[model samples]
Target: MTDLFSSVALPGGFEEVEHTADWAYHIWAPDYVHLFLQAARGLYALLGAEWSPEPGTTRRVKLQGVDYESLLIAWLNELLFYRYGENLGFNQIDITHLAPTCLEATLGGSPITQWSKDIKAATYHNLAITPTDDGVEATIVLDV
Candidate 1:
């Protein structure tokens, strides 16, 4: 299994964080778009999810939230819905539009062939997207 806490090649990346219960990671990217994308990838990593070799599938997503934090949670939870409800795992994500309270994206993936963990939801527990020297970062906690 890939180490959940290993450092990833940068520009945009994620690394696991120690949490007493549930799971958590710190994600960062050069901007909101990449930040969102990295978060999706991080979630999949935590699940140890893998996709099928067949032709990929795609979906369009449009979401709105009260703020960036809520929007982030909604975005991740939407992915979780697809995973458990549809048995899908995405490896391609294109965020065409993003704002303080809304997001639009195209997601591409295939049927999930493997998943080692069950993450119930992406929590808002101490969640916040903040600016950094190069981009933005957030600490995401997932309910397992």
Candidate 2:
């Protein structure tokens, strides 16, 4: 399966891609759990956010929607709310439950300051979660 991806053009890791008017990310991981976690990490990296050394605080997050893509947007938007509302950024995430239309996660991280940029929200533009032989891949576009 890995060899199949090697012969094909595929995103095996997280990276930022060029977009016309918004920030976008290409991300893939070994499973849905890691996929979402990487998405969160990518968002933080795009913001150039600096985290405090403290272990920070932990929070429970839940998002329910009609499908995986919708849930993904909502989950990321919740994280964005945490960033703008509480000045928080998560460095670690534990997905306790994940389904096609719902998810529950425990995020552990710290307060952040001095970001180079601001992200308004995650958008559904070109949002697609495609399954791979070994995992899943998706492109996330953020409204900046």
Candidate 3:
């Protein structure tokens, strides 16, 4: 199998794992969450796909967070930022920061022409993150 932390080609472009748990213990999960954010930010920088002010055009994204809901919100917010701020669309998301309460990721491709399906605010969908043997894992629920 391929290395989990190694750089891999994503839907947007490419991504690499900046850090991961080494099967050890830790005090709080937030510290690790920060690492994931940093990594994801790095990836976004590498992609070099800026916000395009087009209609129905998908663009790549790089956003970070400290919790599931926050992470999801951050992801969609970035899309919203592109949409309202620059009139762009968001499509695929490449999540490199896999943490229980944090996330770092890069997204690609959003339509600028197509209007948002619904204008809904971000909400906490009772998100949760948990530690696992392979590092950290969590499922973010977005109230859209």
> Top model by TM-score, which number?
1
For candidate 2, lDDT tens digit of each residue in 22-57? 889998988887788778778877889888787668
Weakest 10 consecutive residues of candidate 3 by summed lDDT: 21-30
**TM-score per candidate:** 0.91, 0.88, 0.40
| Clash count (model 2, backbone only) | 0
TM-score of candidate 1 on Cα atoms, chains taken together: 0.91
lDDT of each: 0.87, 0.82, 0.41
Positional deviation of 136 in candidate 1, in angstroms? 0.8
Name the candidate, 1 or 2, with the larger TM-score value. Answer: 1
Give one digit per residue, the lDDT tens place, for model 1 in 1-144: 112233654358998999998899999999887788888889998999977898978899999999988999999999999999999987877788899889998888889999999999999999889999999999999999
- What ordering of candidates by TM-score runs from best to worst? 1, 2, 3
TM-score of model 3 (CA atoms) = 0.40
Estimate, for each residue in 1-144, the C-alpha lDDT of model 3 and write its tens digit.
Answer: 112124653211112322232111111123344433332333234333343455434344455566554765565456556656865443344556555455555544543454523434333444444565544443322222
Q: Which window of 10 residues has the lowest lDDT sum in candidate 1?
A: 1-10
Check candidate 2 and list the clashing pairs: none
**Model 3, residue 93: C-alpha shift (Å):** 2.5
Error at 22, model 3, angstroms: 43
